[model samples]
Target chain A: MGSDWKVILCYSITVLYRLWWIPIRAWRLPLKNGERYFQDIEVPEGWHTSAEGRKWWRRYRATIIVPHALEACGLMAIALWGQWKQLPMLSLVAPVFVGMTLAFIAWWRHANRARIQRPQRVAVSLEERKLRTYFSWSLEAALAMLIAASWAIMAWRGDADIHWRWPLTLTYVVIGLIVMKAQVVKHGWALPANRTAEYQHWDEFRRRYASRVLDRMRFMNIVILAGYAAVHSLAGVAPIGAIRGAAFAAGLGLSVWMMIGIARGETAFLRGSARSLLPPATTIIDWKKGWWSFGAFMAGLALLMFWPER
Target chain B: MYLTVDFEDKRPLYQQVVDGIKELIARGTLREGATLPSVRQVAGDLGVNLNTIATAYRQLQEEGLVAVRHGFGAVVKARRSDFAGQDELRKGLRAALTQLVLAGLAEKEIVTMVREELAVVGGKAK
Candidate 1:
């Protein structure tokens, strides 16, 4: 309830919420591409409700459902725990709600992008289709479980009594398992389509654009890591409170900056005038598997959250 | 093995798959006794119905182009020594030529196109 506790709670919730959503965002990049590419197409009558269309509709629904459900369940669990314990953890939920709002705004902007209406049909490469399947079904689900388990286990193990912890833990774990099961789904073609020379060209451009954005993201991460290292290395001489506050501000600033940069970069690339594609289009690594990077981010945040109050 | 499907083409999906695989075989890209990608794999990769890919494989099996063994997926069957399908092949060629002629292709042009395609196949064989 106090300002200091509110700060700590907000910081913890921010890290956990981002960990849950970032992978979903990354994995849905292809689906986003499909939406953008088909934005201007005049599909045949009843295609959206046809068997082929329904298959793709299911994929999009599945893609959106898992992350939204996890966020909802986590919030409900936290709210229930707060009510039962008579705790003032509403501050913790504030930033997460803000994040969801921001995410929705960005998505709305993406959907409204100027439609280029190319004559080519919307098709995914064989490789992209497989990767989407693997991520949605296996990798992302596994990561979500780990995140939920870790959060629940730590919450139970930390200062809370066994009586209170069991219900909270059960709630969290049950939510996690349910979401994981639902996440084990494969995406289908957004449009009934195939790989062609033109599609290959588009894929190559996407890879080039994706790589450039990734390079920038990697640089930002390195800078943030070095900032933390510098702060920790100065712990001996600097006042601990001042050092911690500065480190928190710097880290949070870098994270917000990086996320905005990624969103803007994606938007610009999708709408960019540079239509030239590099030849010999190969299957570009989607980097949707950047869970390790996200893992490192969560680890850093966890370390900060549990840093001893001297 | 690589199997591609073009959804924009006028032909049925299974027929397109069959034609693509047949072309691969004719060019020796898929050699005799070589295994093909599983029906499931083809369907998954192409994002088509499983039954469509199965139908294509069944057609290939019927034509003696590939053998669909239970565990082995499909393998390009070795050319029969007796080779009694020439009449069938000739009939297919005539039908194809007739369609091309109906579509406004001249006889000389059709013959020239056929010769050019055979030459490419012959080159690949050598």
Candidate 2:
């Protein structure tokens, strides 16, 4: 494969991986809130019955999924336009991938809305709300750093072609940073003071909703880890030109281990029935830890990209 | 109806619900023969378990303010005829005064406070 194509392939693969991992990111946000946000939104009233539900859906789509889809489409368009000047078969893949991507987005939106509309009990406290916001931004920052560093290394080493893709990666990082900063401003840089009345209300909500929230997180993490494993395995097997085999190996191992840790933590929380005991701030801290680990993992991979074993 | 249940209030949700309803009955928000929303309806509206609502309704039934029909819903069975009477008001005021006294308030101070409160309520405090 030509150098240009390697760049295109790398960008495509990274975008696809990130897209698949979205649910994992989404799940982590609520869990990060120390399971408080989960209890809040999962309450027995239909999603349509509350103002918060509508806000959640709108922000989720706008801040996370829409930006991702737009970036994916833009990257794919650039790839196809590049290929159209040369290979027709490559152009064909673009339309199919784009269509399927849009379909998945639509399906996800519909399913989430339906789920929200169900009569579920949610008990949420201010502390939990703060945690949710904090962790979500942290996760985005971590993922964006990983993706950006991966692309940076690829560009620096001349392993991937399109230099223009740098701006898009930067945009993701900037957006993530802005979100995190916004959370800091909103939360006054401290965990909420204990409101016993609200805490009691939220405790009841958590007791009912914790299991479902953990299950959703586990399912999403499993899917993302599996997809990463499959794709990386294929990349290894294929006789692709200039494959950063070691970096890919390290990334896959770390991703799998991270997913396992997430599963283990979720299981422990569920089995111990410890959601009620754990403060909502703890969820944000755990989520922040996850992001730190993710950032370190990506940085490690980027290092590998610099010194490849030929 | 406004409903609040305090989990740490050393009172069960059902008991709290019952107490709230009793207060309503005492205050005459629930009139004699007034139909109450069904247990299922209240449970759905409050986002609580149906059993919680049932327990509250049962407590109200025991108090004779509510009666359950076979196919219909719980209905107010009796009115607290003296709910608004001076004796009942005095008893309520005495209960309030007793609570304050128990909390270390002096009787003379409470009497003076009550007189001033009455003056203010009567719009002659100025």
- lDDT for each residue of candidate 2 in A135-188, tens digit (9 for 90 to 100): 455655665565555445444443333333333423433343444344332321
Task: List, residue by residue over A132-183, the lDDT tens digit for candidate 1.
Answer: 4222446446644544554454443433222333333333333433332222
Identify the leading candidate in terms of lDDT.
Answer: 1
- Docking class for candidate 2: incorrect
Worst 10 residues of 2 chain A by lDDT: A119-128
Question: Candidate 2, which segments miss by more than 4 Å at Cα?
Answer: A1-59, A62-310, B70-72, B81-99, B108-126
lDDT over C-alpha atoms for residue B24 of model 2 = 60
TM-score for each candidate, following the candidate numbering: 0.44, 0.28
How many pairs of residues in model 1 come into backbone collision? Answer: 0
Q: How does candidate 2 score on lDDT? A: 0.47
TM-score of 1: 0.44
Give the whole-model CA lDDT for all candidates, comma-separated: 0.50, 0.47
DockQ of 2: 0.02
Q: How does model 1 fare in lDDT?
A: 0.50
